[model samples]
Target: MPSFWSQKSKCLYFYFSGMMTKHKKCFIVGAALIIITNIFTVCVVKLTQDSQSFCPYGWIGFQNKCYYFSKEEGDWNSSKYNCSTQHADLTIIDNTEEMNFLRRYKCSSDHWIGLKMAKNRTGQWVDGAIFTKSFGMRGSEGCAYLSDDGAATARCYTERKWICRKKIH
Candidate 1:
C-alpha cells in the first residue's frame, strides 16, 4: 500500500501540472490577440495616411504635388494671374516625370508653363527653380511653353492654355 504522504505528493504534482497547462494556453492566446491588434492598427494608419495625401477633385496628385490644366486660353501674364487667384503658380517641371505628366495631360494646343526670364533677363522659373535648359529655349523674350516636341520659348503676350501647380498640404 502507498503511504499517505506519497499519495498527497502525487495529487499535488498533477494539480500543478494541470494549472500550468491552462496558464500557458491563456498566455499564448493573449499574446496572439495583442499581435493581431497591432497589425490591424498599422494597416489602418497606412490607409489613412494614403488617403490624406490625395489631391482634391479636378487636381492630379503626384508625389505630394497637385496639378491643374486649364481649359481656357490666356496670355502668359494673364495665365500667371489666374493661377495666383487659385493660390497656385504656373506649373514647374522639376523632373522628367513631372514633365511627362504635363505632356500627357496637356491639351492639343500649347500650354504656358512657369519658365521665363528673370528680372536680370536670365532663365528662371516663377517658383525659383534652377533653369537647367532641359528644352530648347528659343526667342529673346524667354516665356516658355509646353510644346509637342518639348519646351520652347515665345513672347509672353502669346495666347495659350496654362497649367497650375500647388503643393498638397
Candidate 2:
C-alpha cells in the first residue's frame, strides 16, 4: 500500500546510501533537490505570466487603462470615428497624472483628444463629464488635442495624430 513517491524515495535513499556511506545526508539532499526543482518550476510559470499583459495587441498599458496612439494622421472627427469602430473613444484626460503620462509618451505631433469646445464652458469631454481641469485653449469653438504643454484647441478638420483609450476590466 506504499505510495509511488514513498517507494521512489526509498529507492533513492538506498542507492545514495550505498554510494556515499561517509556522508549521511543522501536522503536530505535528494529531498532538497526535489524542492529546488519545484521552486524553479514555479518561478518559470510566474515569469511567463508576468510577460503576458492586460492590454490588447498594439496598445500600451498604464495603470488600469490601455492606450492606442495612432500612427496615421486624421482629422478630429475622423479619428473619433475610428475610435468608435474600435469600441473606444478618443483619449479623455481625467487627472493630472493621466495628462502627464500622455505628455511624456507623446511624439512631436499633437494627438486629438475627446475634449471639444462647448458654449459657456472651458471645454467638455465626449463622455459628458463637466470640465474640471484648467488649461490654456484658444478659439470660441474648436476641438481639443493633447499638445506638448496640455490640451490645446484647434479646428476640428485639421489632420493630426490621435489617441484612444479603454479601461481594463
Candidate 3:
C-alpha cells in the first residue's frame, strides 16, 4: 500500500510539472505583449508631439490648438458671427509662423479682419467673447476674401472656401 501511494504522488508531481511548462509559454507571450504595447504607446506620443511642434502649413500649432487663414467675403459682424457659430474665432496670429502663413495670402487692398471698432469709438476693440485681441485689421474693406492678392473685395462674393481653425481634443 505504501508503494502504491508513493507512485500516485510521483505521478501528480510529474503532471503538475508538465502543466507548468506549458503555462511558461503563455507567461512569456504575455510579457512580450506588455513590452510591445509600451513601446508602441511611446512612439505614438512622440510622433504626435513632433507634428504639433511644427505645423505643416506654417500655421502655429499650440497646445492642441490650430488656426487657419479664412479668405471669405463677409462683413465684420457676419464674420464674427460665423466664427462664433463654428465655436471658433477669426484668425489669430500668435507666432511668426502664423503671421507668415497669413501674410502669404494678404491682399493688396486691405481686408477685414477679426478686429472692429469699439462701441465707444475710442479705437478700443469690441468683442463678444470671441477674441481678446484683434488678430489683424483691414482698411475700408467691408468684405473679406482668402487671397494673397489680385482679388478685389467685390470678388469676395465668388463663393470660395474659407479657412477655419480650432482646437484638437
Candidate 4:
C-alpha cells in the first residue's frame, strides 16, 4: 500500500511538472512576440517622423506640403513656367487653411495663384480643377491672383509675385 501511494504521488508530480513546462514555453513565446511587435512599431513611427515630410531648401514647410513664395514677379504664364522649372506648380489652395495662410503671408503684394480663366470663362486651377468660388473674386481679366482681401483677376500678361507648391512626400 505504501509503494502504491508513492507511485501515485510520483505520477501526479510528473503531470504537474509537464503542465508547468508547457505553460512556461507559451509564456516565453508570447513575451517574445510582444517585444518583436513593439520594436516593429517603434521603427515604423521613427521612419514616418524622419523620412516622410522633408522639404527642399528655400521652401516653407506646411502640413505635408512645401510652398515657395517667389521673390521675383512674372506674368501668369511665365510664373507657371518658372514653377515648372523648379519642379513645382503654382499654389493650389485646397482648403481654408492654405487660403488663409497665403492670404496672411503674401504681405501687401498680390500673388499669382494657379487659377486662370478656362475656355468657358470659369476660373480653373492649373491642374484643371474648377474653382469652387469659395470667396468672391474682384477682377475682370483672364488670370486670377490672390490679393489682400481675396482673389482678383487680371490680364495673363500682368506680372505679379507668385506662390509655388509641391507635396512633401
TM-scores of all predicted structures: 0.65, 0.67, 0.44, 0.68
lDDT of 4 by residue, 29-134 (tens): 5688899999999999999887757888888888788899989999999999999998899998888888898898888999999998755657889988988877
Ranking by lDDT: 4, 2, 1, 3
* Candidate 2 off by > 4 Å: 1-53
**Clashes per candidate (backbone, < 3 Å):** 0, 0, 2, 0
Better of 3 and 4 by lDDT: 4
lDDT string, candidate 3, 43-147, tens digits = 999998876655446344554666554555555556656767766666544455554565565534344434334333223222333323333433333334334
Q: RMSD to native for every prediction?
A: 9.3, 6.3, 10.1, 9.9
C-alpha RMSD between model 3 and the true structure = 10.1
The candidate that wins on TM-score is 4
List residue ranges in candidate 1 displaced over 4 A: 1-52, 118-121
Worst 10-residue lDDT window, candidate 3: 1-10
Residue 16 of model 2 has an lDDT of: 41
Of the two candidates 3 and 4, the one with more favorable TM-score, higher being better, is: 4
Residue 49, candidate 1: Cα error in Å is 6.9
After TM-score superposition, the amount by which residue 86's alpha carbon in candidate 2 deviates from its true location, in angstroms, is: 1.4
Which candidate tops lDDT?
4
lDDT by residue for model 2 (75-132), tens? 9999999998888889988777888888888777899999988666567788988677
lDDT of each: 0.80, 0.80, 0.47, 0.82
